[model samples]
Target: MDERFNVELEQLLQDRGRDFLSLSGVCKVMPSALRARLGLKSNSRVGEVQKALQPHMGRNLEIRKAGRSLCLVRRGEKDEMLLRSVQARPGKSPKTLRNSLPFTAAEFLRLTNSLLKEGRLRVELNARCEPLLFAVSPEGPPTLQPQPLALAPVPDAEAEKAVLRAAFQELEQGRIFVRICDLRRRLGWSREAFDSALARLRRERTVQLHSGDVSAMTQEELQDSFVDENGFRMLSLTWTEAR
Candidate 1:
C-alpha cells in the first residue's frame, strides 16, 4: 500500500511489542491473504513468509509459530530506534544530543564501540550488498571524541600510484565523476601535492574535465580539485574527442 501505511504498520508492531504478527491478524484476512502480504504467488511455497518479514524485522526480532499461535519476540525496541536516529542525521546536528531520532542497531553500536568494538554493520550479500543491521553487546557506547583531520603525512609513491589508478579508472568509465579532492583524501596527499600530480597526469592526456558549472555543484564539488605551489592547478591531461 502507501508508504505511510507501511510505516504505521511497522510502528504499530513495535509499540505493541509484538514478536510475530500473522497476516490474518493485521488485515482480518485469510491464509491466502497472508500469503499475498508475504509477496507470494498463488502457487508459491509456504516458506516464503519468513523472507517477506526479514527486511523490516531488523536483528532483534524473531517470528515463530507454535501450534495455532503465531508469536513474535522483539528485544530492545527503544535502543534500536535510538541508533537509527543517529545514522539518519550524522555529523554536527541536534541529533547529536539525546532523543531527536531513534538510533538504529548500527549507529548505536558505532557510537559505543567498547563492548561491541568487534561488532560491525551487517551486510546482506543477497540484497545488493545492502546494510541490514548492527551488532550489539552488553557494554555501552565508546567515549572517543571525534577529531578534525589535519595534514597527517605525505603519501608514499605506492599510495599515490594507487590513487592515480583509481581516478583514471573512474575517468574512463565516465559514469561517475571523480573529483581531485577525493583523490587527495584517498591518497592522504596535501592539496599542493595532489594538484601537482593531477596537472602532470592531465599533461599526459589521461583524464578530462567533464563539467564546470561551478554554481550547480554541491559540497562534493568543492573538494573536486586542489591548489599547487604555483597556485590553483588546471587539469593538464584530457581525453581527445573521437574524429
Candidate 2:
C-alpha cells in the first residue's frame, strides 16, 4: 500500500540491477518482523517499508514484490561466481547458480551469454529459476560455435503465446526461460524488438530471462508447467490460501 516504498525500492534495485530478495530471510533482520513489514499485523506502520528499504536502496541492492512475497539480491558480485557455482556437468539448472551467486536475472543472462561465447560454459534450463540444473563444460574452455542449422521462422500466434505465457510468469516470479531466437522467428520480430520487449518487461517486473541458453521446451508441457507452483518465481506461504 506504500507507493513511495514500492517506487523507491524498485528504483534502488533498478540502479543496482538487482531483481529479487528473500523477504522471509530479510524479515528476521529487517527491524520489524514480516507481519509488520507487510502491513499484515501492525507491529510496524505502513511507512516502515520505506524506512527499512531506504538505507539499502541502490549500491547493488533492493527489494521486489511478487504478489505478496519478496526476495533479496546484490549485483556487485562477479561473473566468475556464476562459473564457480555451476556443477561441472551438463543438464544442471542455472537457477542453482543464481542461488549461489548475487547476480540479477539480467546479469545472469549477460554473464551466461558471455561465458557461452567465450567457451567457458553452457546452460540447460527448465523454464524457471528453481530446480534448474547447470554444468561447466570440460571441453577445454568455452568457444563460440556457429548454429548447425537455421530454424525456419514460426508463426506469430506461436510468438504471441510465448509472450502471453511470459507475462503470466512475471506475475509470480520475476523471470522466465524463453528462447529468444525462437521467439523472434515466431513473432517475426527483429532482434532489436525482442531485446526491447524484454527490457520493458524487466522494468515493469513483468518477466525476466535468467539465461539466454534456454533449452528447447514443448509448448504444451510449458503451458501445463506454468499453472503449477514450481513455475512461479519462488514458493509462497500465503499463496497456498488460493488453493
Candidate 3:
C-alpha cells in the first residue's frame, strides 16, 4: 500500500506542478476509482499520512509542515519561484510574500530573514516605513539609502505636547496601547522628530516609553528602552496624567 501510494503521489506532484498538495487532498481524489486505487484512508491523520509518504522523501521532492497542513513541492522549485517573484516585483511586503507563497506569517519571516542574512535578499523601507524585500542579483541592485539627517530637527515643544495628548486620547479610545512606529507614521513625522518629541513628553511626565518586550512598566522604569540591531526602535507608550 505504501509503495502504491508513493507512485500515485509522485504522479499527483507531476499533475499539480508547482502547487502544494494538502494531505487531505492527496487522500481523497474527485474520482472514487482513483481514491480507492491510492488506498489512502479518509480518516487518516496527518501523521499517518506523513509516515506513509516517508519513503518518497528525497532530492526529487520536499515536504513542509505549516500549521496542521503539509505542503509538498518539487525539489529546487520554490527557491527559483521566490527569487523570480522578488526580482519581478521589488519592494514586495512580507504580507504579499505570504499571499504569494505557501508559507504562514511566521514561516515567511523566518525564511526571508534567513535569505536576507545570507545576502540573497535586501530590504528597504516604503514611504509608510513598512519594510519591503528585494532580490539581490549577481551585479546587485543599487542601494536605496535613507536620506541623511545632518542635524536632526528639533520638535516644537507645544507641538510635542499636542502630539502626546492626541496619542493618549487615541489609545484610550481604541487599543489602550500603541507602538512607537505606528504613532510616528500616523503623525507623518520622521523617526528623529518623533523621538525628540517623545523625549520631551517623557521628561515632563506626560508619557513613558517601554522596551518592546515589556508590555507594561512603571514610570520609574521608562528609561530602559533599547534599539534593536536592525536600527528599529520598538517601544510601547503609556500616557501619564500631569500631577
Q: Which candidate is the best by TM-score?
A: 3
Q: Point to the candidate with the largest lDDT.
A: 3
TM-score of predicted structure 1: 0.28
lDDT value for model 1: 0.41
Model 3 stretches astray by more than 4 angstroms: 1-4, 28-34, 41-44, 84-92, 95-124, 134-243
lDDT of each candidate versus the true structure: 0.41, 0.41, 0.56
Question: What is the TM-score of candidate 3?
Answer: 0.38
In model 3, the clashing pairs are none
Question: What is the lDDT, from 0 to 100, of the residue 39 in candidate 2?
Answer: 54
Q: Better model by lDDT, 2 or 3?
A: 3
Query: What is the per-residue lDDT of model 1 for residues 1-243, given as tens digits with 9 covering 90 to 100?
Result: 344334544665666444334432433222455446557654433345445554555455545442233333344654444344333222222222232223344554455443224352221221122222233322665221221122222356545544566544554455445555444444433345556666665555555544343332222224335444456533223343221
Q: TM per model?
A: 0.28, 0.31, 0.38
Error of 3 at 172 (Å): 40
